[model samples]
Target: MIQDYLRQQVESKDYQPVFYDLKNAQDLHTFEALLKSRPYIRINDEIYSQLRELMKIRNPTKRLTAAEYDEKVQAYLDGVEIEKFGVWVYYPWNNQVVHLVNEADFIELRTSRNQHKITAAEIAVLSKKKIGIVGLSVGQSIALTLVMERLCGELRLADFDRLELTNMNRIRCGVHNLQVPKVVIAAREIAELDPFIKVKIYEDGMTEANMDDFFTAGGVLDIFIEECDGVDIKILSRIKAKELKIPVVMEMNDRGMIDIERFDLEPERPLMHGLIPEVDIPTLRGLTDAEKLPIFSPMLALDNASARMKFSLGEIGKTITTWPQLASSVVLGGALVADTCRRIALDQFKNSGRYYVDFEQLIV
Candidate 1:
């Protein structure tokens, strides 16, 4: 009976975090009531360490003795209203409550190491930009890196697939999460890593229904990342991106190949750099994976793919189930996409074209 209940309700369970402001008496009372109701709620209070690091960043010119540092820490702690110092985030799924410094101090302390390299001004600039990623297999790495660095103020995610056992080879997540939607996993991870970043989920994945809103609902995206498996969706996305003049970034996830189309820079630029002939979206749909390979190969740039990757592609129907990917390659693609997006968001990289970061070629 218990197993049946869990199987029925797990998919509909809420994954989003809830924030409570202890500064409000009503909220405080509710939180206290929650504490009484669930006495075993895990507590994670790390605001003191955050305050300590925040002090160092704020006073780079001042050298402090151990005693003085502690004194300063205590003084700051005493001055602020402890309850209002940060937020109490409750993760209902795990029955855990985490205390974190507010967005400003939290972001500053978390990304202090990126200073000068990212500059305080650049961080502010990045905080105002919005980024959308349509696939979460390899895009999972890209999204995580983006949140870790606080790259964008808002991140829009779209993925309709669920976490399968086979995805364990590349996508990082616990086995317990098997059968959960990929977007939920990505969103939950983002909420835990940095609550400051706004993550919008397209649970149905990228479809014509939500494409417009995905790009422009809250605000137009500064960058659009495409990583889904559907050939029709890929073509449609580029067409929409071209129409909106939004730049598109895609990583082939093999031999470190990445493509950047600056439709925002050159609106008239051909879709997929004119690599594939135009086709109607309805005709592209309803085709088998084998039938889609002709159009898919060109978009994936399979002609120049690594030799092993090419062989793996050929064995899809015989030996392997599909294109084989490694954790290493997916992570590498994540770094590549994140860096390119950051530079583009900051106007550091302007030209649009395909580029390679092939480790095999660069290492030797």
Candidate 2:
């Protein structure tokens, strides 16, 4: 009976490889070449047209002939460093880039929408700021969104958890990624997106011993994102943030709630706005599910939580194994955190309070 049950469980599982492993030095060389190569003219006519479109240059308005456009394209390409290995990135992925461009040019092209909204000066300011993120499950979305928007030059990430089959519901990865450390996955994604930006990882996740290093290991953070479920780190991080005067942002990922604590402006502010002012790390650590629910409910603002989420919370460790999170909600959390961090870093707003992007209310 036991053997039959185990076989049934194994049969029910769906397993497939998603990402190609970098096995040898050749693979490394190809990846390096892809990172180093600059965007250059592959086919002259095609590249010329692309450059004209990208630059929004047209004849008769900011009139430039084909030759003139070609010259401009060449000038841009000249600035990119030549690939040392001359290797190309060829994987099972949908698209491939023969030549890579400078990080700045690539970012500029990718973040055109953001550029349109904010001034170049604002972007320059954002590029200089360093941001730290703890808990890569939902934090992964926030990190990627920040990178895509070019919000910061450096990112510090901490998460000791490994990716599991269960994490696939919200995390944007494939089955093959199971068992990979969350930090490694996030770092690889960021590096592939923009190699110029620096990423510091704490593979052990934030703890009493390493939490200090995560905050002040390399450079002081302009903004700190707290998303880990660890009750101890959650409280301890805020204490440190208050001491350093760094701004803090968090997303509940349930009911689309966002919490902003401007420790920078209000150094005396209690952790989580004093929601659990008396609860210390010792009391929080090693809490049972039943014991944790009381504190967790208030911290997440259960009174304001959606009906579905509130219902789900009640089922934890019962019918449900854990708190349920939707991909839509997780993705929304990323956008909320990114926008809040950007506004704070740019000094455009200094409000410290809780905000919501509740989908239930919004959709209705």
Candidate 3:
């Protein structure tokens, strides 16, 4: 019955439902607070009874008087979706509710007291999106940030390595996840965090051998976040994405700051791809250390002023992975990623190219 109601809500929007799971206590409390503040979320008598009982059981001394409960229920009654009644109580283990609404209209319904400005309805739009993640150190932070924001429906996590203790300083995984594949650990966290969210992990990550299959096989990824460390891999991914017309995003965390790039704005956009395609493998092998440094060094469009200011790359690198900077940058990166994803999905972001974040001077 609950499924049926959910189906109706989804069908009315001409979208299909892929994931539906119950929320945990913390999420439920958060949801309840959201509902209470909306003033427009109606609860039928049956549902009200259940909610009241939950409140009473959870806080016996703070139980609402019958009069007060009735009054509150009455206020929300006018906003009830009569046809969609009673579906919110489907999962009992967790009073929290998470649903992938097929339609964008529902984005208006998701809200929390802490973030009342955002609605679950808006998050649903995010859920319909799929993003490719290409690295695991800062990639871990990127993944966590996206999932927490409820920004994308599915995440395509690509990493070639296993978790090591050395990575604990910056990665999302911990001692319990050591030795586990980065993709596996990230997937487990995603499922536990939101069962309805879909996660596709590429344990081998992306490579010349498998890149074609990964990109062309499943649905086309809406955008890509490239965190892979190898210069060749980054170069190849950028060129291929341009050819395939998929947008690829990359970021570098300089000391406590981040620099992001969006390559392949138009289908025929130019190639910023580094080493593989045009140059033969032998030529790549022949390059000396002096030649290779330029290939690996980031290309900047910095103004003469910015370029003139010389700073040590080693110090910049050290600062980004440090405490407050690392944490702030990760959060900032995720928020930016979320905003970018939203614009792309809604067709609101007209231009697509590169974006840089310099935390040191708060410059972008």
Candidate 4:
């Protein structure tokens, strides 16, 4: 288990990410060269807006002599550190350093290769695939995992709420990132990791207005991962996947085990297969809060609004916390989601629908 290795504090320097600080002019120049050789940052709409503004300032296209480039670098440094310029510099030919920056004039940059266990050929297949994620919490993990795997050519992330301190336990972000919408965060993280990826994030709540984003005349989504806690969201997603002849998969964290469901590829699936004949989009989308109340209330039985209110006033001293569930479940759920995606992307698995597990049982 990763916990064991983490607890042991095993030393493996090679696995550590190297950070090079731009301390001097020489370091700055070296870093610039490194950045120039580094890859471009890929982004969806929100991030594209930010990068577009920077691109206008540092157009890399025209002509800049070494002296001119240096002048621009110094000017940029006046506002931000040379290290904070946001560029990835690496050489494909000799593995040497080059310069890259968020404000560079270049319209595009080199593509980054996936560093996970999966291979380029595997990613090539994923790039041709499209998937939609529902519910921004677990969906956030699914997004990061897929991006890290470099799986999925185009990703569609849907969520309504912005990041909050409550999400820090399960979501991969810091307080600095609080208030950033999940859609924006997902897009930025992808671009920061590899600018070559294609990401489309829907910050607005998914509804009839934007259902087309998931499936347009351009292309039908290849797969759907339902993470929305709303039963309506699942109903809608399953319906759409079935109508489009796309497959749908969903994962839920039950204690420590993950509950996985695959619909459309199998004959008798639960929830997803329950709504439509092989699942229809509208039926899925039409699910209501009332219907979900029963399904979710049980999971939240430990929580009490009165107790929570009392705790807020220091009466109960804060008894309820998501940390236990978040730590044991969220990360594992993400890993399982990624592994399942890898299998699906590689054409290695067809198992589907309503699977669950608990990690404590395994440990015991």
Candidate 5:
């Protein structure tokens, strides 16, 4: 039975897959031509009724005749060049072209209710900013949330780690993606979600050599998100960010702690709230688990950590293998970081400091 199921899954199908790099002008043109060749407009009954009502409103003094309504519908269809506009996304996984509406229409429809909350002008501001996220563990959630909200025009992702079965606990992915680089998995998912947004990948991860490039290489990032586990990177990234005058944001999945450093506003701000004052990159990299606890505990403020997390940290090299993180906490961290990034980018909030989205505190 299992063999039969496996066989069925791999069997070839009648549908031939088509792939295209929409980034290329020729490929995009080809996609547009294909869409035009077999033009399709699917309007449900409800939308048809709405269209009729809209036609009636065109002339309030006189009710629209059936023939006039039909003419208006036809004119509306004639005006729509379905092929000419829209972001054409070619998904290599399934080999399909997912056509999304053009930018203006897309933004307006997708964020219609967000008008009073985020304001149209604020959304336009977010669309121009570029954000870079290093580390795709907790960073995965942050990346997806940002894309869903249309927070930035482009994203830069860096992570040397691959998707292992162990990562499934926090990183949202399927079993088929095992061993694939985290950056590739994230980029592919982002493309499927919004291919119009540009994504640049740093597969090698952020290192001392490429630290400068990661922060300022492609385009000056409006915001930098740091969520990796490397202590060296934690320190080195901030140094570069401070020098480049870019704001930095980080989320600790435990206890829902968020750190926002607005180096762009205060270049003299200490890294990690002055927790690792005198430590250099090499020194931080060489510290052992026991040796590093003193520094980390202070920064995390272990006294304020959740009971489970505090206990888990005490068992690092003993019974427990590593620090504990939950999907719940990671998801919350994503939301927290997204909101912080949005507020910071929009210039609505100016104070830079430590923040907690602790469920323990909020639930009560």
Candidate 6:
């Protein structure tokens, strides 16, 4: 009985944020109970601040008196009806309750600055799209950027690895998150950023068994981001993406090399831009991590890799554990991915090919 108790897994609900519309008597009761059960901080000032910014967006040409602005902000609140105003967000992971305006007003105020750049119409279209990112180390930054831009309504994250001290160099998170599953850390951070984004996690990582479901279970992903370390999974994922007509995007932290496979447009295109030959899933699956390194190097496009990166690769297993990655490179990769995915989803870029944003050559 003790062993069974110890083996029980944490419930998925704990990782997600719950909303409370205090106007509803039942939800209000639950909210009160939650506060009593766990130590929680109430944060409602942001809602009024949201109202203040929203007033500016609506009246961009006006320069009103302090009294006028305060009144304007109050006009939307309708005079202190906390129960009926905005929303009460309860995050179980951190036990913090945040007060936020309704979705429409919150988005308007939050993304107001993004106006001319993203356009209100584009934001609306992007909000309907869904993206899936596999692997959470570097994928963490990419996923966060996508959410920050409100580029997608939902994000599906998959990772079987947990945070470690070494990952701290690249993956952004507090040491408190050490040993926690990467998906959990990303989900909690996303929740804190925007409770509206629907995040689905595959703690078990991507595999042939769940690949189909991961791509389509919550509606076919508009874009799929692959950043895992396993060669077998990479091959398997592209095969599935091709079969499902989903475009796949990736970045190598080495030479700023970005790879895009427009399977949705060219169904017959070869995997890895014809660099990798036809592969047998079972055969690739049977290869161990050490054995898969030979196959993975080709995907790196070594001829373009920086000389230092080449030397670093040679150091693997001899002087170091594995390929080296820096926080800057990971963050840069994230930006490249988020921008590319957004453009593709918005129909701004087309065609399948390899591109590089290498700073070494461009900086000079």
Q: Can you tell me which runs of candidate 3 are displaced by over 4 Å?
A: 1-121, 255-265, 273-278, 281-292, 298-328
How many Å off is the CA of 37 in candidate 5?
A: 18
lDDT of 2 by residue, 1-364 (tens): 9998867742111111122123346766655555467334131113334455555422336867677776766665565422321223232222334333335555565566665587778888999999999999789999999998889999998998988988989998877567778887887677667656788888789888987787887788999999988777888898889999999999999878899999999989887878864666687887776677788777768888888877887888889877887888889999999998888988988988899877678879
Tell me, by lDDT, which candidate is best.
Answer: 1
TM-score of 6: 0.93
lDDT of model 2 at position 339: 90
Pairs of colliding residues, candidate 6? none
How well is each residue in 118-205 modelled by candidate 4, as lDDT tens digits? 5546655776787777777777777777777667767787888888887877888767667778777776666556555566777775
What lDDT score belongs to each candidate, Candidate 1 first?
0.88, 0.75, 0.56, 0.57, 0.77, 0.85
Question: Runs in model 4 with CA error above 4 Å?
Answer: 1-119, 256-264, 267-291, 295-325
What residue pairs are clashing in model 2?
A: 37-100, 38-100, 38-101, 39-101
What TM-scores do the predictions have? 0.95, 0.79, 0.60, 0.58, 0.79, 0.93
Q: Write the per-residue lDDT of candidate 1 for residues 274-336, one digit (tens) a residue.
A: 886677779987776667778888877888999998788777778767788899989998999
lDDT: worst 10-residue window of model 6: 39-48
In angstroms, the error of model 6 at 202 is 0.3
In terms of lDDT, the poorest run of 10 residues in model 5 is 10-19
Q: What's the true lDDT of residue 359 in model 6?
A: 91
- Model 3, 1-364: lDDT tens digits are 9999867742111111122212345645655566677545443224455434434443446668898666655554456542233333222222233332222212222222214344556655667777888887677777777776667878888887888876675666558666777877777666645545667777788888878766666677777777775656667777677777777655545433233334435665555433233544345443543454445554432121133133333234454332122545555666666566666665667565456655556755
Q: Report the lDDT of model 6 for residue 171.
A: 96
